[model samples]
Target chain A: MPDSEGHPDFDELELGAVLTALADPIRRQVVAVLAGEPDGTERPCSSFGLPLTKSTLTYHFRLLRESGLVRQVNRGNSRMAQLRRADLEARFPGLLALVVAETQQAGKGAPSVAGNTARAPH
Target chain B: MPDSEGHPDFDELELGAVLTALADPIRRQVVAVLAGEPDGTERPCSSFGLPLTKSTLTYHFRLLRESGLVRQVNRGNSRMAQLRRADLEARFPGLLALVVAETQQAGKGAPSVAGNTARAPH
Candidate 1:
């Protein structure tokens, strides 16, 4: 798979960068949505429906992409993002699943997609 | 349990803070040491033998305590730290184990105890 410029390659993925990227509630929420997709779906950034402004959304997406958590591509007129699930699992088994499961658990009352910050899993 | 001032309470733990605390290689190593300890044993921070300055070590411990990943208590002349395993598991099931496992996996050859940055799972 071709990676965009500025994104870390598979071998370059480091624990610190990945954890830092996932450490943000917004980014974790984004990963939750993408990782939960059944068919490796790539969704437009707008589909996340985060309350963050466009710039903030861009920043979070960039962090995720740079850390190798998400892959972004320019599709038609919109930029779409998808979780690098296989790569992450290969490098760090149980890590992403824990993150997604914890996020989902913490955001149960008000899912992070609804704009509320995830509570427990952070 | 009585948390010292500035430490996040059990109910106050947030996923972002925990992930950010773990994002640092040194801190992850510290957590690794403590989490691997038998019977929830608390150890003096110096026992980890990290190569950082004392101030830097103190800083990492504080970050861990603040994020609810570790708890510290004064024992005689030394302050001891231990992983808040039960609390973390209660708040974020499977999260801490994933972090410790991933950190261990990433630091397989060198072992973070020796001061090398973890290679993968970042």
Candidate 2:
């Protein structure tokens, strides 16, 4: 079981960190998927279907987790991921919604997120 | 007069770019300052008073400008900067407002944005 203690609390989340985590186009896609999931449904990490190595996906997930945007936990042998929507909304209202909307827009062949990187901000 | 062609147009702005530009604490502080200024008020870049070198400040301003969050133009030899609030708001509604609000919450002695660099996300 992944410890909930590892996650930053709502009040503990920094706006910069949260923004940085969502800065990547791939991470924004992850958030869009999780945000649309039913409440309390923790989807397995592999379910995101991003075209990246497991290691890269893990790194992105860790960024989201540390930034308090998402929570991951062990469910039997699988690690599940879910958005901390309620907590994030409480802390910074409408932030996630805008990102999700943007992600959807990007998917629909809108302007690309050029010059953005998937790597953590150094 | 800085050429408007140098800046990305509304349709050209990317969500990831904007988020990445706001990812840095110093840049967010810069945005907070510009967001509060009156309509059409172009503040000189040096007037921001950030404890950073001129090169570093120029880099931050470049990131904000390229990300379409700000516009800088030459005003009688002094480079003036202003938030691209109207453009950003049209692209991503409520995004700037939330960032400004979160910045205010930060000002109230909230949790600090540690680990976020003043440098660009490389």
Candidate 3:
């Protein structure tokens, strides 16, 4: 993806940076929205419905793409994001599962998890 | 555990911060050590033998404890850290599992964080 400053942004981030970028709920929502999205396809920056402003949204997307979590290609005047599922999962196996599960659990379910305790590996 | 400055450091960290703190391999290793570790117990910061300086080691432990990934208690002059497994598991279910899986993948296996290609979720 072509970074606005005429440089490559998505290739520069390390695994930790990408994971850190994805840790936020807002960012996770962006990733979930992206992962469920198609490859070589792009989603508009504004279509995701974030709580922050456009600039902040830009920052988040930039971070994601930078960390190799998402790849952004310029579409006309807007930026479209596609998640690096294969790239990241290869780099960190079961990571995508972890992200998807956590994001889904955090968003779709709200059961206080009061009774869910560790069952020790048998 | 009590925060060195009076406040509870572990309690103050949010879910994202906790995840962020654990994103690093060193931190994750620490968590693995603490998790496989028993509760109501503590491990000295030096026992793990991180490559960073003592101050940096202190900093990482502080960050881990602050993030609720680990709990620290003053054990003489050395602080013993424990993973708040139950508390964290309650706060974010399946999270400890995710951490364990990722850390193990990153450490025990030195397979380059390479791409395994995506298998469409059919």
Candidate 4:
């Protein structure tokens, strides 16, 4: 597993890449979950319970990390992911909030691919 | 050129599609330019001066219009485009502002494909 060293520096975060990484419904749901967590809290990738294969989840996490939206670190045997909230807020103010808001709205209104129902216990 | 009838309504604007449309640097540049204009101001598609073929520019504008980010209307032989500021603000507050701010920052910094230099007089 690659380490946080691969994460883009705050100054290196590009708006286009970040937005592109976040354009997916699943990715936005993952981001919304991380955004809802208490500050500094890190959760393992499995904790998301997204309706995706393990490899697909891994791909999503890698995209998130490379886009500077999330930071991933090896936690024992699990890979823990944390939103780079402060960095994102500083780099693209109000962007994260909108993601969270939109995700929540989607979760409430429709049965989207990334909606809460999609995360039902397996 | 299709009329605004093909445009997505405010309620039909999906976050994923909107973000996907905005993910491109060229599209972001167009949004930034429209955002900077006075409220209700509309500009013809050719006015953007983007470095792209006519067909490619049409594709970008279509994506923008279909995503509900920009509204386009047939003005004689030319199509005029305007940012759907009010609808976007009502649907995803702060998102457009972030787009504008990031584009401005990119414009001032390194020369990017969507930077101000790319819009230099042809």
Q: Which candidate is the best by DockQ?
A: 2
Number of the candidate with higher lDDT, 2 or 4: 4
The digit string of per-residue lDDT tens for model 4 on A1-122 reads 44766799989988888998899978888888878767766777777667889998889888999999899877667777789999999888888888888767766775344223222122
Q: Give the CA lDDT, 0 to 100, for residue B55 in model 1.
A: 91
CAPRI quality level assigned to candidate 4 from its DockQ score = medium
| lDDT by residue for model 3 (A34-108), tens | 776565567888988665689988888877766677777777887777777777665555556555665565555
TM value for model 3: 0.59
lDDT score for residue B61 of model 1:
87
User: What interface RMSD does each of the candidate structures achieve?
Assistant: 3.1, 1.6, 6.7, 2.8
The TM-scores of all predictions, comma-separated, are 0.76, 0.85, 0.59, 0.86
Residue pairs with backbone overlap in model 2: none
Question: Which one is best on lDDT?
Answer: 4
Interface RMSD of 2: 1.6
Lowest summed lDDT window (length 10), candidate 4 chain A: A113-122
The residue-by-residue lDDT of candidate 2 on B1-122, one tens digit each, is 43663588889998888888888878888888788778677888789777778998888888888899899888778788888888988878878787778667656764444336635754
Docking class of 3: incorrect
List, for all models, the DockQ compared with the true complex: 0.41, 0.63, 0.18, 0.53
Candidate 2 deviates by what RMSD?
6.8
Clashing pairs in 1: A14-B122, A15-B121, A15-B122, A18-B122, A121-B15, A122-B15, A122-B16
Q: Sort the predicted structures by lDDT, highest score first.
A: 4, 2, 1, 3
User: Native contact fraction of candidate 2?
Assistant: 0.88
What TM-score does candidate 1 reach? 0.76
